[model samples]
Target: MAITSANQLELLQTAEAVAREKMIDPALVIEAMEESLARAAKSRYGAEMDIRVSIDRKTGRATFTRVRTVVEDDELENYQAEMTVDQAKQYLDDPKVGDTFVEEVPPVEMGRIAAQSAKQVILQKVREAERDKQYEEFKDRVGQILNVQVKREEYGNVIVDLNPGEGVLRRNEKIGRESYRPNDRIRVYIKDVRREQRGPQVFLSRTAPEFMAELFKMEVPEIYEGIIEIKAVARDPGSRAKIAVISYDGSIDPVGACVGMRGSRVQAVVNELQGEKIDIIPWNEDMPTFLVNALQPAEVSKVVFDEDAERIEVVVPEDQLSLAIGRRGQNVRLASQLTGLDIDILTEEEESKRRQAEFEERTKLFMDTLDLDEFFAQLLVSEGFTNLEEVAYVELDELLVIDGVDEDTANELQARARDYLEAQNAKAMERARELGVQDSLVEFEGLTPQMIEALAEDGVKSLEDFATCADWELAGGWTTVDGERTKDDGVLEPFDVSLEEAQNMIMTARVMLGWVDPAELEADAEEDAELEEEQEA
Candidate 1:
C-alpha cells in the first residue's frame, strides 16, 4: 500500500492517536499496515500474482507491488524451483520463488482505509494485554484496600477509575451514608476479583468482618506482634463489637494493651469505625466466667449451663437486666457469639420466684404424708381391733379401695398404722420375756432393741440361736437385714467397718469355736436344756 496524498496523511495521524490510547508503540502501526496490504494483494491476484508491501512510519507512505510468477521448462503456473528463461524475461531477470516483482497497488484515494485496518489490530491486541495485566495485579489484592476515583453511574452501579483501569461498585457494596462525586477519592476493600471480556474487574466491600480486623491490626501493635491473639470477634458494625482476646505470655495484659494508655489505641480503632464502641474481653477457659466477661458493662450474678441444649441462662441483678440485654438485645446477642453459647437472660427477681414455686411443691408433699396417717388409723379399726400379728400381715394395696382412700393416702396410712401395731407387739414380746424367754433367744449381736423384741416373738432368743438359723429364715437374704424389713419397722442394718476390723473379728470367733460342727452343737444345746429342766424340778 502506498500513502500517495493528503487523505493518507490523516489516517496515519489517527493511528498514532489510537496507539497512544491503547498504550501500544506507534511504530507497530506501520508493520500492521504492510501485513494487511500483502494479504489483500494475494487475494486480488492468483498464481500469476506476486506482491511486496512496505511502509514508512514517519511519512505515512505505504506501497504495494504486483507481478507474475516465473516458471522454468515446466508448464506449471506457479513453480518452487528456478524460473524458465522465457518466464523470467517476461516478468523480470533474477526472479525466484521467494522473491517478488514490484508494481504499485495502493489505491490512490483509499490509503486511509488501509491505515485504519492496521490501527484496529493494534488497539485490540493492546486491550487484551492490558486486561491480562490488570487481572494479575488485582488478583493478589483481594483483601486489601485500593484507592479509587468516582467516575459516573451506569445502570445503578458506580464506575470508579483506578488510574490504569476502571472498576464497578455495585449498589449493595457502596455504603449508604458515604457518597461520591466525580474525581472524589475513596478507599475500598477489594472484595473479589473477576476476569471479563473488557478487563479484570474488582469488587469492593465496606461491611466485611475482615475490614474491622484489618483496621484493628493497623491501629494496635500488640495484635501485629502476636502478643495478643483475637480468639473471637463479633460485630454489629457501626455500633458495637465484642472481641475475645488472650495473651500468649502471662506477663502481658491483653485488654489493657488493646485499650492503650488513656484509651488511645482503641480510640483510634473506634474513629475508623465511625465512633463504634468496642469491648475487649480477656478470654478464659472457664465457660461461666468467660460468658460473664463477654457481656461487660453489665454485671452478671450467675450463669447456669444447660449442657444438653448448649445454652446458658444468665442471671443479672434486677437493675442490670437491661444492661446485660442491651438495646433490643444487642449486647447479649453479640456476647453469645463471642462465647459460643446461646444465652437466655433473667433477672434475680424472676429466678427467686421460680425457686419459691419449687419449695412449695416439696412442702405439699410432706403435708400429704401426714394426712395419710389419720386415714390409715381409721382403716385399721374398721378391719378389726386387730392383734399386732394381723396388722403386719395385711396386704397394702387391698386397703387402697377402702372407703375414701386413694393410693398415696392408703399407703401412708398403712405405714403409720403398722408402727402402732409393732409397738404393741414389742410389749407382748416383753411379756414373753418375763415368762422366762431364754437368754439364747435374745443375744444376737448388732440387733436393735426393736429387732430383738420382734425376733423373741418368733422364738429366736439369742445370738447363739440366731447364728444357728439360716439367713433366709431371718430376713430371706444374705444381707445383714431381711427382705421383710420396711422403713417404719425393720432391724437396723450393720454400720460400715474397715476390712481389717471385720477380718479380725471373724478370726477371733473361728479360733474359739475350733471348727465345731453346727449340727452337733445344736443337739448338745437341746440336751443341756433338758438337764436344766430336770434340775429345776
Candidate 2:
C-alpha cells in the first residue's frame, strides 16, 4: 500500500471508522497510523535512519521526514541519523550538539509483510485506547446499582454488556441458584472495577448487602433525599436479610417509610432479590435496645452486655428461646452482624441457674478467705462483696450497712480479709521466685504478685519480655478467625488487667530500659489529647 494522493484521504476515513467502532478517540487511531507508517519507512530507508511520519488532520495528507541530530565529534555513532558538530556545516550555521536536522523524504510503499505489521500495530493501539476509555468511564461507578443485559454465560459466570464495556457476575455473586440466558436484563451492584492485564474488569454482584440497600434507596424517596439513612445491612441472599435504618426527620418513621404504604416499597426490593424476606429495624444508639429490635418475633427477658469483649447475652423465656435463635441460629446471627457484637442466647431458667451458681461460688470464697461462717459469707455476698480486695479496701460505712454488723465487726472483717490477701500475695511471690522471675518484673508498679507469678508461668520472666508483649497479650482479647470469634487467654487477665493499663505499663518499661524516649511519649500523649478535643468539638 502506497501513501499516494489517491489513497491519502482514505487514512482519515479509516481512522474515524475504527474510532467509532471501538468507541475511542480518532486522534489515537491517527497516531497509531503515523507510528505504523514510520516503522515501514524505517524498514525501506534503512533502520539506522531517523525516519518519521505525520498525517495532517485537515487535509489527510501524509508528510514524510527524516530527522538527524547534531552531536559532539566523539559522540557521533550513526552516520545516517547523527552528525558531529564540525561535520554539520552543510545543514545550517551554528548548529548545537543537541539540535536536530529535518528534511522531507519520499513515502515508502508498504509490502505484504510491512502492511501486515502495520495492521497489527494499529489494532494493538486501538485495543489499548478502548481499554483505557472503558476503565475511565466505569472506575467511579463502583458501589452503584446498574441495569445490565446478559451477553453470555462462561462456565457458571454471567457476562453482562455495560454498553461501553463488559461486566462479569460470578456464580457465587448471584442470588441462590438464579440462572439467566442471553439478553436477560438484571439489576446488579457494581462491586468493583479493576484494571487488569487483558483489560478493565467490572465485577457485578446481586447478593451484596449494598445491593439491597441500593434497592431501598431507589424505592424510598426519604432514603434518596437523605431524610432516612441505611445504617447497616446483613443478608442471607435469596433467603432473609436485616436492615437497620435511622430517620433524621422526627416526623418520619424509618421502618414505616421503608415498609411503604401497603408494603409496596419493600415488596419491590423483595421481588428483585428473588423473594428474600427483609427485617427493617429502627436504628438506636443503645446497642442492647437495637439488638432487641433486630431479634424480632421473640421476647427478650434480659440483656447483659460486655462492652470490652463486644459480646451480648440475651435471656428469654423457655418458649421464646427457639424463636430468638431461629432455625439454625439465623436470627441471632443476623442480630450479631447488625449490632457488631457476638450474641449468646439463653433461657430465663438457664440464666437463673448460672446466677445462683455464681452467688454460691462467691459465698464459698468469702467463707474460706475471711474466716466467716456460711450465713455471714452469704450476707457479705448479698452485699456485693465478690472478692477479698473489695471487702478489705471498702469504706467502713459500707460494711456497717450489712445486717448485725457494727463498727467492731467491720474492722475485724477488713482485718481478716487484708491478712488473707497479704498471705496469698506472699505465696504468689514465693512461687514466682521459684520460677526464676527477675526483680525488674516483680518491682514493676502496676503488676501484682499474682500477675508476676502468671507472667513467670507464661515465660515472660524479665522486664524486656514484658515490654515486648502486645497489649492484647496482657489483657485477654477476642480474635475473629474464619468468621468465628475465639478467645485469647492473657497471662495477667486473671488479675483484671485492662488493655489501656497494659499499654501504659509496657511503655513505662520501654522508657525505663532506654528503648523509648520519654519526651516522645509525652508529645504523643499531647497529640492524642488534642485529637480527642477536636473530635469532641
**What is the clash count for each candidate, in the order shown?**
18, 0
Residue 258 error, candidate 1, Å? 1.9
| Error at 127, model 1, angstroms | 2.2
TM-scores of the models, in the given order? 0.47, 0.90
Q: Which prediction has the highest TM-score against the true structure?
A: 2
Per-residue lDDT tens digits of candidate 1, residues 1-537? 445576557658866875677665555655555665665555555434556676666666666666544444665555532355655666676666445444566543225664576556655656665677678878998888766788987766778887677887877665445556788876667889899765688877755656666667777788888888888888776778888889998898998988999999889877766677889899998889899899899999988986533579999999999999999989998898687677889899998897666555444433343343444444544555233334345676666647776778666655755666567557756875864566544443444455556556666564444545443344322222431222222221222222333334333334344545657767877999999999999
Candidate 2 lDDT, 1-537, residue by residue in tens:
899888889999999999888888999999999999999999999999999999999788999999999998888899999998777788879889899989999999999999999999999999899899999999999999999999999999999999887999999999999999999999999999999999999999999989999999999999999999999999989999999999999999999999999999999999999999999999999999999999998999999999977889999999999999988888998889889899999898999999999999999999888888999999999999889999999999999999999999999999998999999999999999999999999998988899999999999999999999999999989888977889998777888888888889999999999999999999999999999999999
Q: Which residue pairs collide, candidate 2?
A: none
> How many clashing residue pairs, candidate 2?
0
lDDT of each: 0.66, 0.94
With candidate 2 superimposed using the best TM-score fit, by how many Å does residue 372's alpha carbon deviate from the native? 1.4
